[model samples]
Target: MTPLSRTCRRLQDSLNSFSNTFIFIFTTSHVRTSLTPTSSTPNSLLNAALITTYPPLKLQNRKPFEAQIDDSLEQPKPIEETAFDALKPTRLPSNVPLYSMGSSSSPSHTIPVVSTFANPFETSNSIDASSSIRKPISLWPGMYHSPVTNALWEARSSTFERLLDPPLDAPPQSELLTKTPLQSRTSVLYNFSTDYILREQYRDPWNEFRIGKLLEDLDALAGTISVKHCTDDDNMTRPVLLVTASVDKMVLKKPIRVDIDLKIVGAVIWVGRSSIEIQIEVTQSTEESSDTSDEIALTANFTFVARDYKTGKSAPVNRISPETDKEKLLWEEADERNKHRKRKRECKREVENGKVDDRLEALLAEGRVFCDMPTLANRDSILSRDTRLENSLICQPQQRNIHGRIFGGWLMNRAFELAFSTAYAFAGAVPYFLEVDHVDFLRPVDVGGFLRLKSSVLYTELENPQKPLINIEVVAHIMRPELRSSEVSNTFYFTFTIRPEAMKDGLKIRNVVPATEEEALHILERMDA
Candidate 1:
């Protein structure tokens, strides 16, 4: 139908047959000019200026106007603006301007003025997202295009699957301070080869039997082993030694097939070797290379022990904590009293912005924190008491100044011996370790630092789970995600007091009892705030 709609239905059927033969010759020239009073019709003002210069047309093609443009090109609906078309001219384009064409002009009238100021099958010069003559489709009808369509009114029905923005309900991230210090503190190490040689004994893949090939890492994976080098034959001696040093291959792009074949059993030997002798232990995980088959009820044997170079015989070694002097005088008084501190402190209020701890200097300079944590259990009990103090004893290296790097109070006293073994199996017997108060340094824990202290006792009072109020949280972390120097965050409070049947008969006590009325209204609202 569109050849300007079949030339507007052949100019509305030739203007309805020339308006019925010009209204029967103007009703016989108005009955012969009213019977001759003034017989004038010659060119009546050039036929009334050619019938007021053509505008009105189309008097009949209802229904089949190509079925209303085939249902407007099949479902292109949503252009509804009925307040009677919002009183027209809101930049007109839902295919507008089809006014009521019903009168004059006819050489098969086709007037399609769809110009992007002048388009013609678009593309190369792009302009046609419904180009109503390059915008400004209408304004002067009675003037009020809603303040110019309210600036193209974007009520945002947004798309492309909501394009990922709705995640900011804000408030769960903060604490990443820096009056200027998140860059430049480099120290990284993972060195390995120094002619690496461990020998309890397993030695057959000398490059898979010296150049025989099955070695692109146990290739299509199949394991059959037998190795040598422990001539006192602890029955073929192979405790374990996987020394793959073929080098340079970690640049993969596709088709990686690693069907697994590592069953190492431990033998990184050598009791002595110095002059910069390496000691790398990055067993990325066989559960740190040993408990892969996980069967741990209690397995705490962390002994490094390595001192016999000349036999003044020492042993214990799990080092990791190296610099201190009160952390170089607390970074020289934090660089001379906040060395001109002005990193982020002008928030002059009015930032309802993203909420997580409410702009605490931009949520600790963006660590994004939000913590409400503190509910583990309340009455049924289980608070932490830990025992077996003897099988796990027999130490020899006690040089204790432990100063620098490893002291968040010695990793919170070895994480309070792992929460005293679950508060001594929930105080069915003995639990007493009182008073550890509100300590919140908030940040600044360093020196080759390493930390893990997670204690939980969400509720209990006098009825003893050891007089509870233990909510210890110390997560000092660092995994070299580009090393974060001296990371620290603290929030601690401990108030323990438990003595279940005092280890059965020894006489003990407990405290903190507000059993209820909502824990005495939360201990009288923490003693009135």
Candidate 2:
């Protein structure tokens, strides 16, 4: 036998020996009473053992022995020290009749002996399973216990088994977008690296990887990076909530194919008092290496904010100092972007109050040099030839996050899908995702709310008719059924490139048509911004 098998055999033999020794002392009195006074008692107890094998004598109205067992045996001990106790019955209820060992084997008079020797060499797997068996180690409540092996894993971070058999209360996949950062005294940063192939399952009708899935991953990665940047050694650093504030300058350079290994990496580029900017880069390679020959597929910048998990108030984060030249450049750019964003907000407020600045009015004039060129008028003329597309749906529970609200990724997906459809129809051929210049999530959408997504061809460049480029605007609004009103939730700006056609002679392209001056100005403002 193998050493393990031998050891198990020895352990079983010891358990049987211990049980027989313990039970022998308790049943000796009953054995002695079975012998008649005329019988000669053997000095060696071999005779007593022989007598126990015989049929028990009937005693009319005689009560069974009520022997009191010492409580010392019941005291808790280490599993190794009290292994034999596993063989004993846990409860001895009064309703079960106790049988004498010295009983007949006949059907009417048979008495069952709790046999330790009969199964001494039997396989351990043959033992009947019962909850009464003492566990070698105790586990916390709600943890799973195996019936076959009686083994358990550590509760912390052990979601592998639970994932296989998920409970109804488990959080949706979107809830994993942001995870708590590991506590550390080192530099505050996050690095995300994941590889994906353009599998058929992730493709759209055109057999290209869906831009929505890419955006979803980007949102999740950005959220994780934000959480990592916000955490520090401060005792007040509670679990912080993070959300995607904006996605900017996301460019897709090449079409992703099923054969290419798409590698995406994300890292914290800059941090503000309560905001974090994460730069995520997507690259494709024929082979796994650090070779420069690898193709650059896409690049994106994402902004996220740390908020109080409970009150939803903005929370401050630790500052990051730039050490590298690239970091320094990005830090400066982040500051400039923040300033420009503030100025844009102020400009919007001025426009909303019907107080346009002289400079803006000059920029909007009918005809002059660059300062007085009627850009809005040109934008309106271009929008006069395009078709608009729209889609709407009621938010469902499946799209909800752990917070019981629609996930930002899901909203981005809906918007991107509609935008793709609009671009495809306008291009008269397959349109590939080129870039998402900007996407801003304005407000959270509650579950069961009506979601309206509108897409339009904001601009198109067909100067090179062989290769046309189209820009689309996708807007999301949440509608309240009771109020009969809708509030804007998101605005997505996307750019797409149509497949090149062999045009011996150039083809004239149709343009987007905006009817109102407000629409024209809105398009012009975004272009300038």
Candidate 3:
């Protein structure tokens, strides 16, 4: 070979060696420190370690060796170059708080001042350095923001504050409007697999993604969608107050992995004169290819009631005009759900008024038989009271929503965890979440109030022996000691099932019998529903 060609060949080989070394150093440092397995390491972390090690090797081969050599000769670049130059950590001023956008002179260092939710009307020059108000940072489209951020933003907004407490004489209908569903559609992306800091914020001790955290995000997104649907202008003086009325259902279609990027998409599906229904879906793409279709991980429906901020009465919201067939179908489904909710409410009233159908009567009679004649009851069955588990704590400000009330999603998360524990204790196996049968936000919980959560494995279905279903109920009560009062704040029903693998140990769940007429009524009601 010619001297020039030989020289080029040597350079190419050296470059290849350098690239490989670089990849090794980068992967080893990050994976060793961040992805190291602990005693409590989850399966997902193991998979993440494997993924982190191999992907960069393929990156080195993106361009041909000859091409790289030609580029190197033209540029005469240094040998110790790195791909992470853009990622060099910024060293902020010593006075500036990390992860905070607060005033440097502010006395308080506890609460972070996130700029994403800062008051839109306030400029940096106009901000009072001595003020303790937490401002929001600018957020780009598709970026993920926590529920706290949303709350802070709302707290800082003059428009939202007006909505929260408007002038008593303010008109209920400042404007009437209609909007297409697409106009309010939003998608928030969580790049957990790629973003280290983001992953750390959401990663649980088990190295898995925290579903509770995601629930908070979902609620935040739903609230955003509701507000988007209600407002036509960015600078509205009298925006309507929207509060979560209920979470109709939340179904887990697939397990969410921490190593995968997640996208949460939501939009207003249907709107009544004073209510809105939103659909939120969580999806994840496979690591193998971004072009591959995303797998849906979860789906949920959130209902919000719009009220006049001044009068504290139901207020009309902008109607949604379905533009696409899918949108129309979603609207229809939401309508059906609305009808179902009404029917269920009427049924509940009937049961309360001592009116019952034949099927319900039969189920109630069967429940009485088990309660009245314990000796004649099946030996494999256990009283529902036996499957009960409970926990209580004071609701703190950290769990409050934009309205200053405890967030519905936080309540759901707490109830879900307790329900899972209840089922696990009853089944003696790790239970997989099936779905949230229903969630009722009967009363708003106050921060600093005594909150009690009671969970019970209401019943078990063994029709599918391989995957026995456990129906669990959780009741959240707000208690006041001074008045000796206890009122139900929320009701959550969740369904879980044992995996076939878990059932291989010859484990069988016993049927649960109602011990009282009240318990019997609950069982019959659920069965009828």
Candidate 4:
């Protein structure tokens, strides 16, 4: 349990660290709010508290929000004699102009003539005199809010708000006009606290999930990531994947979330007993083969795993940060080789604007091992750069088959010789024949013609660690010396797995790289390709 907790914390720490990175920045304002995550697995974000001060409003050099009743008392109203409807002020009733007349009754009672400014007899729309009433203060809600003050002080505050220059809020305006940097800041903060969760939390769904559907996982579909925790036989229960991250460190307060992509090629699943032997007519809608260009199907075996998926609480999974060195190298090599195919010699040539693209240098440098392939006469036409091992031999005349064409064995023997020449060096110790996988003859060979063979190491399994078994890909191509430039007579793959324990104990392992994803998938343990 502690181990899992540790894993969760670690993942959270990583997420937090990555979130702060410029590239992984939080770009939205909504993500910027303060959030407290309680757990790494299914991290729970808590509500945030906001802090703000009441705003002040000013009108006519006076703070309109000032505590007072003068605006209400001063508000003007006409004596309603006729029962007629009137349009009320759109703004708050208090905003209506107010008129102050001498408390004493004016002579206007003598016939009571309405003043032009405050007509007592006028209806709401009769150029009402009350409309002319003026307040010592003015208020604009768009600019400010209620303020605490006396009438005189409020008036002064309102006056101040009116004088506030537009440039005072220029900075906030510019921010909205462009991008709101606050959003990015918030996103980074959130991810910074949540990254660690992805690691172990991802394992639980699979851990609790039952592979109820056959061939479903085979379809390589993404499984449901969210699932309920299940009780185990031991009374322990699974937990959700949650994580947190700090600056550079990821801490998992709960489980971590992790996702991986895996591709399977040439898989053979449905294994069973005699009655279990499942066989079905599989129609491989095959494509027409091209005779002019060499056609070949590539195959591989692969596996996906998380070095550590330990998750729990109190204490979490013990991390192997330093222990990943070897794994890192192995995956790096496998991935790099898997992505690239043999490069054509023509690809190296350039005639752009009479100037070569210097950037090509980077490509060559990355594929340093591949760039120095030996150039043959028809270099760019048919032979591959990696086919050198098989290409060296020029097929010589052999007793022809019944029809007088050379026997295929003669060319096959040449391929064997080419493979043995380089492979024999490592066979000084123990040589284990792991397999002689599917071998195909693309075409027939004629007598007295040159045959080229190329061989490369695809993968090696060091079961004992001290001694390794090598899987060599020996590809042999047959070509005619008479018309070698225009024709390739035959091609085939001869796969051999040999262990080097019998070799000189002191010799170091070199030139042996790990299998590619495409190549490894073909050599998966005991599963024939």
Clashes of 1: 25
Better-scoring candidate (lDDT), 1 or 4: 4
Clash totals for all candidate models: 25, 5, 7, 102
- Model 2 TM-score, 2 decimals: 0.56
How high is each candidate's TM-score? 0.16, 0.56, 0.68, 0.24
Q: Candidate 3, 417: how far from true, in Å?
A: 1.6
The worst-scoring run of ten residues by lDDT in candidate 2 lies at 140-149
**Candidate 2, 1-529: lDDT as tens digits:** 9644564565456446543343333343323233343445443343344334334434554345433333334555556756555554333332333444222321332246652222334455533222233211122111221110112122211321222123334322222222222221112111212223225536567666667866766664555455455544233224555677887777776676644445666677677767877777776664544675446677778888867654668866656766668768877887888788889889877777876445444333332222244453554234422458899899886565434567676778778888888887875666778888777778889889899998888866667667667788888888887998999999998888766552334433455545455665665666655
Candidate 4, residue 377: CA error in Å? 32
User: Model 1, range 1-529, lDDT digits (tens) per residue?
Assistant: 6544554565566567654443211222211111122345244433332333334444454221110122223434457655554332222222322333233311133344553333333455643323334522111110111111112111111210121122223321122112111111111111112212311111232221110111111210100010111111222211221111111111111111112121212111111111001111112122233563331111100112222222324422221121456434434543342222232122312122322232234212211111122253333322222111211211112211111122233333443444444355444443344433323334434443344344444334443432333332223333223565434344333333444445346433222233223323333322321
Model 4 lowest lDDT segment of ten: 222-231
CA-only RMSD, every prediction: 33.5, 24.2, 17.2, 38.3
Model 1 lowest lDDT segment of ten:
219-228
Name the candidate that leads on TM-score: 3
After superposition, candidate 4 runs with Cα above 4 Å error:
1-397, 426-434, 463-467, 480-508, 514-528
Residue by residue across 485-504, what tens digits does model 4's lDDT show?
Answer: 63444433333334444344
Question: TM-score of predicted model 1?
Answer: 0.16
